[model samples]
Target: MAYTAKDASTTLFRYLNITEQSIKVIENTNKRGFIYNTANGEKCVIFIYPISHKSDNSKNFFDTRDSGAYERGVSWNYALQNKLKYFCFAVHDQVEKYNDYVFSLECQEKIIEKVSGTLNGSRIGAGTQVVIPNDYIPNKQFERIFTKNGFFIAVIHRDNIIDYIDKYDNRPYLIDDSLIELDELETNDEDSSQSVALDDEYLSKLSRNRILFGAPGTGKSYKLNEDREKCFADGNYERVTFHPNYSYAQFVGTYKPKPKFRTDGTEYVSYEFVPGPFLRTWINAQNSIKSRTNKNYLLIVEEINRANVAAVFGDVFQLLDRKTDGTSEYEIATSEDMREYLIKECGFEADEIATIKIPSNMYIWATMNSADQGVLPMDSAFKRRWNFEYIGINQGSSKIKDSEITLKPYGTVKWNMLRIKINDGLTEAGVNEDKLIGPFFLSDKELKSLSIDEIFKSKLIMYLFEDVLKHRKGKIFKSDFNTFSKIIDAYNEGEEIFDFDVVSFLPDESNEESALGSVAEEPGKYSTENE
Candidate 1:
């Protein structure tokens, strides 16, 4: 049976010889273990079964064949992997019976001191036993040292666990601090307050070739740029926007004819293979990996869904799968023209020029808006190979510092309040949340400098006409205007004529009227807009 926090606390209190009432259980969950608050306000967690290297059956302690044993092993491994401070206990016999166990603080201390050295040794394994000190006795009846066979329990202080979780909360696995080797500190960087830790934790979980998908205005493209800046240097990254005209010839490489001028001013045409963004980025990454530069290369594809992905990738799709060592899973045959170009211009070996492979250090990241129309649909086979992350609409206020704006007649308003009102209006009009405006729609500088009329005319008006109206027809505006052009004409006439305030544009409560002056009850149409 799975043990609860109460069960662990009861067992812990009995073994530690502490009064149960003196401690309060703060949190007890399978992932976090049992956190208990002591009388003095200090917190700690108890591990029901902790595996050690010296104990018998240590090798099979974590074996999945035994469900009960496997669970205990996982819990113990999590604590040790995260470098949490804990106490361990080994029950001698009758593992199922809890009443026979007795709490001894002296015994616990001696065991910890002995096991500390073993943890630093090379042969450490699950269930490994510690060499108890000679002064410690297992029982009064027996003078010789006794080894336990039941199970191990570990106690970890809460502070250490909290810190570890805070730093790596997004990570899929607990970070093993023991395996980390620190590098020498740089002398010139002594005054640097910035953390040297790499921001590749999210990338580690993602496939080498991945895409970010979300509703329009969700900041998908913005996040890709952010990642490029954070994880890669200037020379290490390249970017391209995909469109309906994008093809394999444009994405990869193709033979193109160029005019060659002669001395007599007569022009002659020469055909040469022109390399595209993918091939160029791949070759650069391959060179970096071969030279052991330890640098990453990233290729960012914006509006990836706008083009036919399968057609653009062609035979190169096979190169996306990476081996365990980060090299391409397969080397695909290249076209004769590409082979010639690779050998002559790219400096590839004669034998290697026949095939091409994506380097492991090369990463391909794309962004797609779920609301886009006219995009070529990707099949399951192609999408399953790439990891996808969804960027949701910003639920909080804009990150812009000291953001506040004042409308001539509406008085001063916070940017967050404006966003809330706009979003509320959009929602009331039956517009999907994904199509709602995002925080980055207007920048900090624009909000501070531009007048309210200019801001509304430039940003919100354009959004309504080009985006909301184009998709939802005449549903979002007041009933007086039947078309987007009519609304624009009305707005141009005078600011006072039409209330640009978000609340005024909301659907009428009594009739659920459309902006076109019709009693429309249908939900607003949805559409994707390129960022």
Candidate 2:
């Protein structure tokens, strides 16, 4: 048996010693535990109070007003309701006798016996005991006679409310205050949950060696730039755009002449050394990690294949290799050496000799456009250093309310699968590999704002698919003007649009018998019959 708001009046009469001519479970539109004047729909919430102040240590019951009922303060009553339905209860301390005499009555004990059987039991670490059940059924299990004022609370599962009570009680345990606080605060203010907390574990899990590879015009650069700003704002990232003109000196460091005056009143100059962005970023990441043990840093190398990988990386690449991957390090000559040595080895100016070493904290992220005519494939050695993720123009990828979109895969995973489908479809049509867009190019924020028709009118879809189609064997996809139109039509009227079956993942609904026929009618789809 499971306890519900319907049992509220009977339970209160038997346990709390409150008597009223009539009582009704009031369900409200708000998401909080509110007392109102109606009961209908699953959207309503019901609030439960301690049965009797004398039976539990919780002081709420003892604070009854002149009307002889427990009085919830202003905050509890006036707070905005914005959370899922929840049941609240307070337990009494056995040692306190202030109100115990009333609960000792035989009639009260009989009610306790009936409800105790459905309670769940658990030991919370110390000698403390807790009992939660689907329904308060006497003789089945022990009931929670006491509540730990502010220390212990349970968020019961709607369905498992019975099993939880039978198994967990009088067990030692620790409770999570933050979890409960988040729920209560949402109920208090009706605010949606924001970004997950920025903690050490999350930072440590960041993809340090990511490569955002995509076709041209798919918005890879935009997303990369956005993430770069976020990482930099946290003071843990450095950005450098790569090009054919970029040299080792520009990336690492170089020595130059500075004007000076000679002792003999003759004009003279002296050589001075200067550091570049790469070295600066390496040093900064190391210093940041030293101060904040769990922090991570990012270095964005735009158009990574534009420059010679070996010439640019020189010696630092090996030291930056992921430790988990077991790659070997390389030894190389430094920018600084005796002028004579530099002259003999690489024919550099004598003033350029000085030593600089790469730090270990630096991690590299790069972007490569697969569709650029001038772009050359990265060398095998350089390619092994990065982890590539393809970005594509996808509506789901750029939608903000993707989780609520009601798809088979639900959220981001839906976008990933769709990207795979596009690639597979294009492959079947004999499209070349070069034209495939990387899925990561688009963000969720960009998708939901535009309708399918609006997106198609922009010809962005044709621009995206054309590159891959050009490399294919047939002229069937060659007409850019028509290709865009067909692509748009498919997106708008496709039958498989809702292929990701999300409803199947939903939990069983309560009251299975009433919904049995409807659930059985669609065994493969959303079913409530077994609830």
Candidate 3:
């Protein structure tokens, strides 16, 4: 609640605390603002302009006829750690938009020059300084941005010092830090600068070694995919899944046989070092850095715990501790094979790839379900290097409510309804939440299938019969559906699997068809991993 806090009115008066008497927009003024003391040893003034999206317009952004008075509200988007932070204004659902008119030539140009790479935003036509997708804005509450918790506007910041023009009006600006209540904590400008530097969003953006872990089907993978598409803008990324046999050599790099023909036409086998996902991504990040390209690179590891993670990461484990700039805190020396490969093939300096270090723009994210059958436990030392995000069972229920699950014999039930019933039963029976089904336990196509297909049974019913409901089967299914084969057969053969009259909870046909009409399922695109 920076706006509500003492000495933070440039934003509050400009957008939130609006009244004709307090923050009136001058008829002829393009923008106006006052100065306030920040902890950075100087004054900070925010210049903002009022704008809102017009729903009726399709092609053009702002309506041009100028006679009408516009009523603007704001979406008070804040990080979980820092409450009541920044609010963005944009016509689109994802990226916030601001025209160049609101910013100074320096703020407009320098914002793109100095901050575009570090900030997850793009500028257009040099017209807007920043265009950030709200979700990618770390520490932000994702759902509230779209709901218009309030209307939005644009803001800019610059330093202010006492430079008077004349005896009465020598300074460029008209406001003072004392014009607003000076928060005791913000009395010094340097303290405010340090506070801004340690903001949650800033820290999270720099160091992104995060793991989305939860029970099967809880949308851990779904959430990660979201981060893939939105947070990192779906470019300069690599995806790898880890399993029991997945090893460090495969993850980082190893030499493999390459068949080649000599000039004499004799075929020969050459052992060539092939860089795996990790090294390949690092190489790309290094190239991007060398070229000074403002691109973010990602390494998505699905089912991280499915493999013996320690063995898979091997010596690279130490490289997980990221510095504030997101580079590996420490570098691990590369194997000889890797060093030779780096110099000859990847254009790396002998000194550079001799040791492997993760780059700042490069990120490693993973999905884990400890309840999975073959999952290997992570040591505390390894676990401490990553931030864990637990996907709640209902984390994304709203997206799939229209999905219908039809038991050939029991009839069609809303996917969410049946999922809730199953989860509730498991909970009441004392089954751990981690052993329960998640919102994305079944894909849309799987949910719509009348019979339990191989994909469906293996992904879901087997999970329920073998793990989640192994000891708690009586809560949802018949006591004698004891074995995986038995329950799956019952499910596929039109026999009653659930003890309850689930058909009684079937969603209305009209609602189902109207809502999910012809919505084609793009397998693995939206919901791939069952983590």
Best by lDDT: 3
- Which segments of model 1 are wrong by more than 4 Å? 1-206, 262-267, 406-411, 449-452, 469-475, 489-531
Q: Which parts of model 3 have CA positions greater than 4 angstroms off?
A: 1-207, 233-235, 450-459, 480-495, 503-531
| Alpha carbon deviation, residue 66, candidate 2 (Å) | 70
Candidate scoring better on lDDT of 1 and 3:
3
lDDT per residue, candidate 1, 300-324, as tens digits? 9998889989999999888877787
**For residues 238-350, could you state the per-residue lDDT of candidate 3 as single tens digits?**
67888888988899878777665665779998777776778877876676676444356788999998888888888999898887777899999989998986665444568
Query: Model 3, residue 104: displacement in angstroms?
Result: 37
Across residues 16-42, which tens digit of lDDT does each residue of candidate 2 receive? 333434333332311213432223333
Comparing 1 with 2 on lDDT, the higher-scoring candidate is 1
Which stretches of model 2 miss by more than 4 angstroms?
1-197, 214-233, 256-272, 286-295, 322-333, 337-358, 389-428, 437-531
The clash number for model 1 is: 15
Worst 10 residues of 3 by lDDT: 69-78
Winner of 1 and 3 under TM-score: 3
| Candidate 1 worst ten-residue window by lDDT | 519-528
Model 3 earns a TM-score of 0.55
